[model samples]
Target: MTDARHIEAQIYERLNKVIDPELGRSITDLGMIAAINAVGATSQGDGDVPSYDVTVHVELTVEGCPLSQTITNQINGAIVSYPDAKLTPHIEVSSMSHDKLADLVAGLKAERKQNPFNKPGVKTRIFAIASGKGGVGKSSVSANLAATFAALGYDTAAIDADIYGFSLPKLFGVHTQPTNLNGMLMPVTAWGVKLISIGMFAGADRAILWRGPRLQRSLEQFLSDVWWGDPDVLLLDLAPGTGDMAISVAQALPNAELVVVTTPQPSASDVAVRSGLVALQVPMKVRGVVENMSWYEHKGERLEIFGAGGGRRVSDQLTETLGYDVPLLAQLPLDPDLREVGESGRPAVLNEDGALRSDVLGRTFRELAEGLLRSE
Candidate 1:
């Protein structure tokens, strides 16, 4: 019986590493492990290696939780890692009772409160991607940058702040709705990044994305209602235009810095400066400018598809106007794969296996991400 008790203790220790994907807390700590029963040696035990049959009872936050399989697989992996003992594992998972779930949520809210990022001492780096107009690839830039951060092992979360033109759900390939426990909602995890978008909720593209009757209120909902456990970075894909969303974000997230996206053209660069100029009206910072579709390589020669100096022009203007050095952070080439692969729900800078690519686009994005994290 001492041996059984010892095995159970070890199992509990290992389970501390198994985090609930949505809640971002260990299942064991959430009081999910109701019991652990370990019996004597099983036939599968290697000769004298003291093998035992262990059953772990798991209580999930909700019934038919979409990520139950992922949680189960991780628990199984944790159990089988006990090489000292030949442990045959069985995990019995069931939904927590209504009262228990309510208590757990209440406790979590009381501890962390709502809108966790705005609190003092929070280290989350928030970036709001903006543009003067549509078709400049702001959402694409937001999706790729967020993916690059996640692939590099930074805990990352993104909100599709573009209420009318939400595309992050498609770009990140997220098809699952956030699991709602009582009133609190969990952001969906896809491509190693935590994402929240109305596109994933109502099931239709344009119709569902329009739920944000008030853009500012919707931003608040995404901030307060979702359970984001203090990620290292938070990115907002702002709508393409100089409008209320930027001010709303500045008011809600005082630390949010703006990263303006512009194409290589006088028309785009001219208005791009206005988007960055929103900082003049609000207390947010204008981080830098990203020039998209700067050039296209055609038959061994570089072709200036949209014209060459728009990114620099916006950067120079913003720097002079904002009285801070708003440098041109990156110059992205026009790659067809950025659209095709993105339409397939994967960021172009990442490989099929979800690893950061070693190609030019990937390297450039990595540099951009590193630049953003660097000190001024």
Candidate 2:
């Protein structure tokens, strides 16, 4: 009937607004809506409007998709809320046919052929958080900074470039493996940031599954195989004692800027200079340095726990050696909440509502993020 056809068409149009949380695309656009059938089930009485029952057939990309229920629920809401007449929704779901999935993946791959960040006119601002050694709170800075960027309304993505010592998964509290669509992988989004880490990969042979001969391939694989979709900012939490990883990041993301993290002591600050000096070997720019644990506040006095001026020393050394100004960006406090709440799967810079904390440490990271976005 014309009424049925018109209602079905209207339902399809409504579905365009329902996006798949994992893909960040509409189910209708992804060919997930196999069919939509609508019919007048009954009328209330004489002079009363009729009620229609709409049946939606959905074909998902993967079987047993964790978000399948979410999509169906959205579909139900979209149809049931139609104001012209009363309506009920029935959603039937199934996995996509092998041929359909293959075609979809191939089309997507063809559309996105190589590393999206290296595009000629890419707008993504990439920052590789590096350190001379471990335990300098480099990953902590990376996690909080990415969260801050997202809180500031940027579509942010982060790669745990520290393959061997991957911790972003734990820091961000991501438990589910990435949704693999054919050969392409979807990054797990948490705290409003898209994230990818080897630690989040599943399967028994997960350790060696995504790597090749050189460890650099892991970084490249994260760039090529993941569906990033052109984020406004991309943060890479690089491994400590960096040489290969820094070089790899430069080669992979040509526009990436390096942000070095160091503590307020001689031993950590000395090697921190070497980490920033990596800009000499590659074409990457050395963004300013962040000094972590500069001081601890107890009672009414400030205590320089690790000694002061370490961040400034690294900045001065890098500026002199690299012939560019590498300023001291921020002096982060030695706050215990950074580790305690961070271990609980959320960045310390953010509150429970995912808003940037208005405290000292949070304000410092917000300024760091804003400064990174400014032109030199």
Q: What do the candidate models score in CA lDDT, each in turn?
A: 0.90, 0.89
Those runs of model 2 whose alpha carbons end farther than 4 Å from true positions after fitting are 41-48, 202-213
Q: Give the per-residue lDDT of model 2 (tens digit) for 1-376.
A: 2367888888899999999887778899999999998876574566676678889999999999888898999999999988677788999999999999989888877888878888888899999999999999999999999999999999999999887788999899999888888888989999999999888876422454334247688887899889888789999999897657778898888799999999999999999998988888888999889999999999968899899999999999999999989999999999999999999999999999999999998899999999999945
Off by over 4 Å in 1: 41-47, 203-213
- Provide the TM-score for each candidate, comma-separated: 0.94, 0.92
TM-score of 2: 0.92
Q: Evaluate candidate 1 by giving its C-alpha RMSD to the native, one decimal.
A: 2.4
In candidate 2, position 297 carries an lDDT of 90
- Model 2 lDDT, residue 336, Cα: 97
